[model samples]
Target chain A: MTPDALEGALRRPFAEPANDRVLDAAREAFEDVGIQRTTMRDIARRAGLGRATVYRRYPDRDAVVAAVLMREVRVFLTWLDERIDHIEDPAEQIAECFVAVVTGLRGHSLLNRLLTLEPAAALPALTVDAGAVLAVARGYLAAKLREHQQAGRLRSFDPEPAAEVFVRLAHSMLLSPPGCIPADDDAWSRAFARTHLVPVVTG
Target chain B: MTPDALEGALRRPFAEPANDRVLDAAREAFEDVGIQRTTMRDIARRAGLGRATVYRRYPDRDAVVAAVLMREVRVFLTWLDERIDHIEDPAEQIAECFVAVVTGLRGHSLLNRLLTLEPAAALPALTVDAGAVLAVARGYLAAKLREHQQAGRLRSFDPEPAAEVFVRLAHSMLLSPPGCIPADDDAWSRAFARTHLVPVVTG
Candidate 1:
């Protein structure tokens, strides 16, 4: 489901202000603290709703964390699909995508908190089913690679493995931020697009 | 001093029957209850030594843990350096190193306990001092890669980044093992030598 669909499912009555506020609070509060530490009561307080109202909306902590993460992933995918085509080379596209993925990661308080703060609790929530996301990314890269092969713009190599390398490289970049990963991160996207990213496209 | 120097020093002074027994006890106790939870007094009791005797050898808890870890690294490296040449191909050697590394990791009760039982306590140990151990591993890999490159058997690339990738991949394999990694892992070394590694060595 899309982010909107996900948000829609949370609100049973469709116009329930309490449901929307609870979800917003859950997103913010979970991002601030963590899913393990964030309480339904805190969400309710932030949403200006009663404890009963939160209980009415959602059952427990995991659900809220899931909702927020799902929304973020959907948003990220949507953002990525828009900007991937600007770079001409398929390999470049893949590298830029890796750059893009990490670039996308830096500003996300929820993802940052999950990664940098509570890895034990955060790993499950953040990467519960990363295969689907990886598939989406791989599919995009594979198609682009195939296109380049057809155009004779690059040498013949297995697009699938190359795509996997990009995905894993992106993973490594996140796991241990390189010197170029950006302090303020204002230039991370561009720098990654230029260096680690450009090699993929050119290779 | 290097792990070799440390090993030689520890051996000359303490490889007699009594000291060996104490170290064995300390290793087992550390594995059973974690570094933080395992006490010197408890270790001394396990080793059949008085508190004063244990304290006489290693002044502090940290000292004992460092000694144990140092001992473990020395043995693993010495073991690896021997079989490292048998693989012949640069690709196979690197791949073998990964599988061997994992197998060696399986029997490491202390490292396993540190990671599984108390990650918050263990992360600092890995990161506190400019990541010296990681730098050492990176250095070793860089040297090996350069050696292979000089022999005209492997692809020439920036060894530093390649070593970084190897380290990151190996580390991830240790932390979050996926189904792609072999459980039995006997053929893992040769299999990696064939599929993932051979092509890159040529590049």
Candidate 2:
């Protein structure tokens, strides 16, 4: 399917009170305390709803945490796919993708809180389970590379190896970020894209 | 200094019982039980020594843990340095370093034990002040890069960026190693060297 079609599926209104309120409460509770420490009652209290009501929405802490993270992951990937889908240049596509990614992922206030307050609880959700959460990123990047190759804009490089490098680089950035890369980031995005990405992907 | 002279000046037997055996005991205890849960008695039991003896050698668990990590680090770096110093090609040297590094580091051994058994206790010692680990690695890698530039085997690439990439890639290998790469062995060393290392380093 085209990027347009995939993104169209995610275009939803913020008009639904219960779903919005449930997510909002989960986000607030997770931010104030953390994923592991926050109770269902805490979310209920923040949302000013019954504890049973919160449980009805999210059966467990892991489920709540995953829901929050999953939303962020999906939005981020969707933004990337929409942003880069039109860019014809492989180097530009990569550069724009990294910029959109670092900016989009880092700017999410909930993720920042999750990473900051309780990395122990949150890191596995993001890093491990490579099969689940990060598959979006891996698949998105791989598809982009394949598009570049088919367009004849890319050099003699395999999409899969390039994807491996990209994913691993993202993982490293997530863990021990460098000061040079503005936590408001884009510094390493330029560095990586210009120096490494262009050379590897371009003819 | 000449290579031999430098080697001689740097070399020492820090293998004194207070140092080596203390570190050895810490490693063994950390290996068996969790590092946080393992007491002085546990270390003493592993070493077949008294609690007083363990304390006499190393004052506390943190010191013992650091000492143990430092010893292994020093040996690993030395082994890396020897390989780098012998290579005339900068690309080859950098590739060798990555291979040695991935081989030395990628495993569920030291870090996996730390993460699974005792996350709270081991996090600090893992990153906060783990000897002069990065400083030593950067120095050795920079020297190798500098030598390679002089020989005109590689283009004028910044050693700092090269070193940064090296460390980051090694960290990636450790965190989410490729399926092909053996957990305990460097069997995939040549392939990784050819694919990832050579592409990045060869100017």
Error of 1 at B163 (Å): 0.8
The digit string of per-residue lDDT tens for model 2 on B1-203 reads 23343344235326365556666777877887768777888888877888998898779887777667656666766767776667776556655666667666754387766755565566444433422444444455655666667777666866655555566556555544442334454545655456655665562
Instruction: Give the alpha carbon lDDT tens digit for every residue of B122-146 in model 1.
Output: 5434323213444455555666777
Which one wins on lDDT? 2
Model 2: per-residue Cα lDDT over A153-186, one tens digit each: 6655556555666666565556555422344647
In candidate 2, residue A68 scores what lDDT?
Answer: 68
Q: Judged by DockQ cut-offs, is candidate 1 incorrect, acceptable, medium or high?
A: incorrect
- Count of clashing residue pairs in every prediction: 3, 1
Stretches > 4 Å off in candidate 1: A1-24, A31-37, A47-74, A86-88, A101-164, A178-203, B1-27, B34-78, B101-130, B179-195, B198-201
- Which pairs clash (backbone N, Cα, C closer than 3 Å) in model 1? A91-A201, A92-A201, B155-B203
lDDT for residue B148 in candidate 2, whole number 0-100: 67
Q: What class would a CAPRI assessor give candidate 2's docking?
A: acceptable
Q: What's model 1's TM-score?
A: 0.64
Error of 1 at B53 (Å): 9.8
> Worst ten-residue run, lDDT, model 2 chain A?
A5-14
